[model samples]
Target: MSYPWQKLGLNADQQADSVLAAMTDGEKFAWLSGPMAIPLHKGEKIPAEAIGSAACYPSIPRLGIPAIQQSDASLGVSALGGVRPGDHATALPSSLALGAAFDPDLAETSGKLLGREAFCKGFNVQLAGGANLIREPRGGRNFEYISEDPLLTGIIAGHNVRGIQSQHVVSTVKHFALNAQETGRVVADSRLNEAALRESDLLAFELAIEIGQPGAVMPGYNLVNGEWASENPFLLSKVLKGDWQYPGWVMSDWGATHSATKAARAGLDVQSGSNLDECAWFDHPLREAVARGEIDGSYIDQMIHRILRSLFACGAIQHPAQRGTPLDYSWHQLMAQREAEQGIVLLKNAQQTLPLPPELSRLVVIGAHADQGVLAGGGSSAVTPQGCLQLEGVDFMGIQTPKVYHPSSPLAAIRRNSLAKKVDFVSGDSIEEALNSAQGCEAVIVFAQEWRSEALDAQGLDLDDHQNLLIEQLAAVHPKVIVVLQTGGAVTLPWLNKVSAVLEAWYPGSGGGEAIAGVLFGRINPAGRLPITFPASEQQLPHPKQVDPSTTTSLPGVKVKGDIFQIDYNVEGADVGYRWFERQQQKPLFPFGFGLSYTQFSYDDLQLCQSSDTVTASLTLTNCGDRSGSEVIQLYIRPTSGRYPSRLAAFRKVFLAPGESQRVSLRLEPRVIAQWETTKQLWHIVAGEYDIFQATDAATPGLCGTLTISAHAFGYRVA
Candidate 1:
């Protein structure tokens, strides 16, 4: 009566026999094909039968085991029937906001929250973490991605994974290996040299594995080299299972399995989101491989064993599944507010212009998204929120204020706050009329949100005319003016000098109002930094569309805009982030890792180590300024030889008391210093000298030391 899974309660050998005996080779094959659908952000058009009643355990019932199911995870739970069942949890700020926060512990908490939500939703498996570096600004899925920096992405992803698996839910660290860009992701071959991929794209995934140790790795949709990711034996069997020792099951991306035999042979233990047809497994290539004794019943059993191990490890097989109750709009709303508050970045605060004086006699607020909370993004990660906080802030505040529209903005939240004597709503009126209406106002607030996409790159770096006009008009009437940006990503700040204050509240979730209010009133300090570089102008970037493709448009419906590698890496080369600007002696509006806090921090006690095998550095960090704050210590390594122009070596986050200082260690494996010799087309290392820097920002590599690396270690050609 006991099933093989039940027998798993016994000793290992017995359990193995129990599982093997219960299932015939065919049943084992069925279990070996254990793959589930990855629900897209856009709710699926499901067949009703599979909705309320899931297709439970075909093999598990027969052999007494249960299969696992899951979903993509840019934000939280994917909605169903236009109802968000999981909104009771917080809709945390997008990954960019979290990255901007620059606090790993904060990122850890965010991940834990997401994990709790997943646990509540009865999801056995979820794509909880993976570092997909945002190589392109126009990357369609930028909101879901962390940052262009590998260290930041890895840290954030590791936090997220640690949170999920701690709740006993299997987390998939995914689009595994190299999947930096979304364009032609399914079919395009990533023409990457090993050094490029390893240092930039693949580094994060490797670091996540080293730290997070997730139970599942979803191979990408694209072809890695010439072979599909699903069937790349070199990648899966060699790199993943052999070298890295990743014992977890390898699941193909949804609809990403290119072939059955090769995929299985390559170490793909599960085919995710496959249609319920046995043809893929039972058909020609795999069957032939089996008949020829290349792959057999044992291989099939082993594959199922890996999957079952994952389920058991995550406690999905034996634990009592407690599905959560229906979603609560109010809880979701509050979560949105907290996230919005954390997400609001105080970019500039000249003359102490913010926390808009509570003694205001009159006020004018402006932007469209101000009232319409940015619920979600477009492309693979899009999902409709149950309730948004954009419109309701006014009535809650019980304040008399004017709601002025500047196309799209967050002035609505400001309008609802206290101290406004008379409220007036304005749209497209002349500057004279707008200024006249605000005659008695002591200060003005401008709401600016940038909405950009791969389909249409930013026309220019500047804010819209409506926003420009609104700021120019409002500043004339009121010497004190503050601008709040509610956008998916970055924008130029031409009017930044003109405004007294600037807040980058990137698409704050449902609590757009309360969160903004909290930051504005100094209830909370704005610590969010710009995850991506704010371009000085559109011309500053290497435009993909401008290349010699001579193409006006792309495939219909949805399409990735440009080759991120081509634009960001090849053409732009090493001139990325503060690296490019500083190297060229050009200035950025705000440098990478630049964020002004209500408090201040300082760095000291620089130390550098140069061993034969490694280079290490350390620094003493102190919060010299008032408020309790955190600072990210950046490390850069530059080889004296031409192997690498420059690269991030190591980094650490230090939190300090006002005037309290402590020494922290920074480490670098000499391997990180290895680079490719482009002329000879081989990886190279030099025993010659290299420079090390410990600094606040990449541009300001303030403290420096020297070391040398052996050229022999890296002198090898790629096959």
Candidate 2:
């Protein structure tokens, strides 16, 4: 006999409605509960049965609904162990690294590879699209996000979503809204005005959803304004579901759900996450709410409808899990290496210290156990690459704790690259020894690292574990000291002036070592740019005061007692990152979209064309230097109204051969240029002459033109 859902129609909504029509309250309640995380003894495998899942929702056998098998893929297939021993997922470059590349094509490729891996390992839902803006540089999870600019973040995340969903996997665009800081994340109320929300942070989500059309949205643990994100009506129900008209399910971040009725009312569909007790918040509570008439039965039906709709809409139901599919590790590893090579940003190349002299006789690489492997960011997004960790290194946390290193040998890769050069590796454990070894070397390249986790922010931008001292010592001895930094986000460089060259090789993935070697050996030209600003010092930051681990309050009278900490985003408003720096007139050590190429490029022949609906900026780029390289062409819009400093409107990364000239055109989406007017609850495109800045980076505007809008443009919301 055909099920009621199958009999009704083929359309996802109809199928969902039919399924909801036949389901009993008890069965629906069962569907709401989460799949269990199999407890593991120290060093024990996390059971093959739990292989494909990072978080799960129970299946309703009667309705023929399979359990939702989810995977955490912030960077790449996030898993500890899979079907067998040593079977860990492939780890790609951190999201920030991908952002640095500024290539949507690469982002999509990374997403597709990870999605394929997730599917091969039996996961239908991938939580990979993290578009949260880097409002604070020290955020523990900045590595997990794309960029500070909403447009760039959204575009990259959109491609990622498209790539993931192409494999019949549901891509989740996450942390709903305003989860900028991680210090008071779980309990903090992210207080912000609606205008700032729509113009900046929320706008990023809007664009990503508009482009990616993800199958699901995961709400963060923090609060937006006053309400918890999981139960925020304005964000989830009004903006996400109503304005954007998102046809996807909403899942709570692991342990993010607060109240059942509130969450359902606010549009949260699934409560899937870790921590059994926390995940059960929607289970028994929902049943009781429905029985007591506190919550309507329609609300429960809506929740089930959303979940079923996504499964049908995304093809998750049709493409059921396939177990025992062996992954092509070599191909995936190569892709990871390519991503690393493309994303590693060359920050400073003074006197051409990089593209190291071809036939160097002596070269010394120091710090970060580069001989063994490269580092990966910590927390839920962390993926233990196959063979990265040994049993001896596995700790009480079940695997590597605090930090995990991928088994990509940088020393071997460098040695392979420089066959003629004598490469010596130093641990840098002893500053004196490292300094001694650096003496009389042709050049010294220090592989410095700073570990970041989910719940903790960095102490400051300074490199931890005394890496600063090592760099200083090495710089003292050698004229050419190249620092290869592996960090989640921007780090202060006190010794920046002393260093000959610096490469921001953000938590490069499994094949990071090979990518580093290629860049160092001139096999690859660095094209990546800074996604976030590099402040001169911590004092220049919006919040110069360090987070007091013991203190409960951030501001006087703002008590952080109990489970509530208030984080105010009101003062800063929409000025984040470069915008903030611009408004404050504070010069950053390194500006956003800044990257040094071996070959120099020049921008000229600026042009602007505008229609009633859209505006386009076109310019010619010429490679002036001898060597071929790439340049990230950034476009910023400065309204005559002066609501805030110039905002990033558009950007394109262009590659050119020596003396090669090409005209590149970029369209400005009216929505991106418009400012959200909280007073009218609408977007206002001020009627005035606006400056269009064409530049290599945010700080440097080489070409500029003025565009005038004859009449004021207003929209209900960004479309």
Candidate 3:
């Protein structure tokens, strides 16, 4: 049976007729755009959309259709109820932290937590984080991007989207087409090669759409190929809808919708964001032109019809329960802990420093972050984790846990575990103090958290005075030294030489403390791989700091002593990521997918299956060590330098058992026979040479396969 929304509103086919039947001439005029209000947030202050009547408040209520409120969220939903913006909620960590955790279940839990918050808080939808361009590391908004690589971003974020939408709250994957560089975010035209943008940047959005089927999508403020994103039909309709069949509403970036006719024609459905919501577009000359036979009313009807369709599809009109309750915070917390425990990459495990045998009576924990929780990344995605996590020595053995309360910290498990015995907890701001306490102790674990806050990104990649010095100091004193590095992305680590073990415990959400405890004492196996390249040093990155030569403002990095920054591309077109370094034989701190395990695994029995259009490679993976663990199988297909340069073809995350072997397979797409026509801008599959590789690291290809294909051109370029 059809749902109630089908008749109350109209089915997709009858949407245009339904909208026309419901709207009068006056109503049509009012639906265009609202007028702006006074300003509020900007430079030297907080980042927020709704302020005290700031940025031109719109008259959306006059439109006949009750306007639905929306808000920005890089992490949890921060929606204010009623006509005026209300209370402030706790902000969570950025996406950079989630990327480090590298666990999908955890990501979904976070999304679920935020979605319920939106429903309870009275917001209609949230611009769920961002799927913008990760053009360069120095890009101001890089912290929001999950990874430079698209596959990793999609797999992790897709689950999060599903979690949100599954809760019946609308999640909008945002900053739509190529808003990669932040310097010129709202204005800069991202002049990128079409295929590169399609395969890398756009690929991320496409994957999210495939996985989550978001209820709405917010257009970016920038211009792609000389046109604003909200007014680009080629991007919204041709690619997102026609090809992907995305049945969701499209809203403009706050203040981004420029024209009335053009925006409506570009497949835009809602205009409640910035200018689209506040501008008096309906009464403007351009919209009047559109209504008085100068432009097609059919276009306007199409947009309004799309909006009605979205409201109906999301069940916003028919059912309240569809959007789930807001009490799932604890559930999400548990899920996050599980993911963190699972993906915290065991980078280096020397002489069994980890899983410190339970016999150790006295354990020495150093670093200020040990007792203090540091959950999630910084900036817009930030969420205030409710209560304090219990930590070792944090609770007086005789006294109930003294909640080490910090708004953003993630300290818990230890506080509860110490109930059995009094664990020694010491906080030292310097290495000497921390080392002295660790001397003659059973084990020492240092929480080396690298914090990157707003206003300024990380100044450099070195450990701070206490962190760097303490690593060498504590390792010498404590026989078992475990180092936990937490940050958005990888930092060049020289301390690897001193520490017996190193763990990349990327910002693991609210339950980070519990996850850390579980991993430390061996509750779950670590299985995350670095999505971004871990450069040998910050110097290995492009010098001028911009990833593309097309950018304007230069970013911070090593400059000419006195020069703040200058726009220049020293790496040129050749030296790009792991490709440049690995292909050229310069060693990286760690390969792209290099993560250690508690047990050893072997890859063998390489086999290949080739088709005219694709290739499939298969290999056998067996756990040869004493313990059971999981591993991520990375497949990198580098084509012979004929058409395009080398790129990552396919990747898969796999699990295995001790003394157990499993067969694994990966599929390679049609790039094998295609030379993307750069000048003419088309993909033509030509007879080709292909070099396929399957491995655990970028530098090492455990298996090699080759294939040839006939010149087979694809049917079309939907994108």
Error of 3 at 711 (Å): 3.7
Query: Where does candidate 2 have its weakest 10-residue lDDT segment?
Result: 390-399
Cα lDDT of model 1 by residue, 1-719, tens digit:
66555643564334545666666656565544433332223554432212121112342566555445464464655432223343433455666777777666666666665666666765666665756776555554566667767766776777777766766667877776555445445655544555566666666776777777687887776666666777788678866787567767787765677676677788888765554333455335565788888777577767766666666665665663446645454665565466556556788899887666564666665444444444344333333343433221111011211211122123455555544564344542366656666666666665665653222233345667877887776776677877777665667777777778888776555456667766776666666666667767655654434321223245222223354212224434433455455555666677666666777766676777666666678877877877665566778788765445456677666667678888889787444566545556444556688888775565566777776555554433354
Q: Scored by Cα lDDT, where does model 3 land?
A: 0.59
Order by lDDT, highest first: 2, 1, 3
Candidate 3 lDDT over residue span 1-719, tens digit each: 34333465456436435545657655555444433322232322311332312121122232223344455575665321112333334334457555645556767877776666666655555668476634455444555667665666776677777777665566788878676554435555544455555666667787777777777787776676666788888788776777567777686765677776677667776564333244644456546777577668676666556555655455543434322334555665665566556657788888877765554566666664666675444333444444444232111111122222223332346435333243566665755667677866666777786654322245455667767777877766666788887765667677787888888876665567777676677666677666667777866765424433233235443232221222222232322456556555677788766777777888887776677566687888889988888877777766565344455666666667789999988786544224455555456766667677777777777777776545666634523
Candidate that scores best on TM-score: 2
Off by over 4 Å in 2: 1-9, 40-52, 60-64, 81-84, 274-279, 390-402, 547-549, 552-562, 712-719
RMSDs, each prediction? 7.0, 2.9, 7.2
lDDT of 2 by residue, 485-588 (tens): 99989998888899899999999988999999999978898899888999998878776664442565544535464677666677678888898899889999
Better candidate by lDDT, 2 or 3:
2
lDDT of each: 0.59, 0.81, 0.59
- Residue 8 local lDDT, model 1: 32
Query: Candidate 1 overall Cα lDDT vs. reference?
Result: 0.59
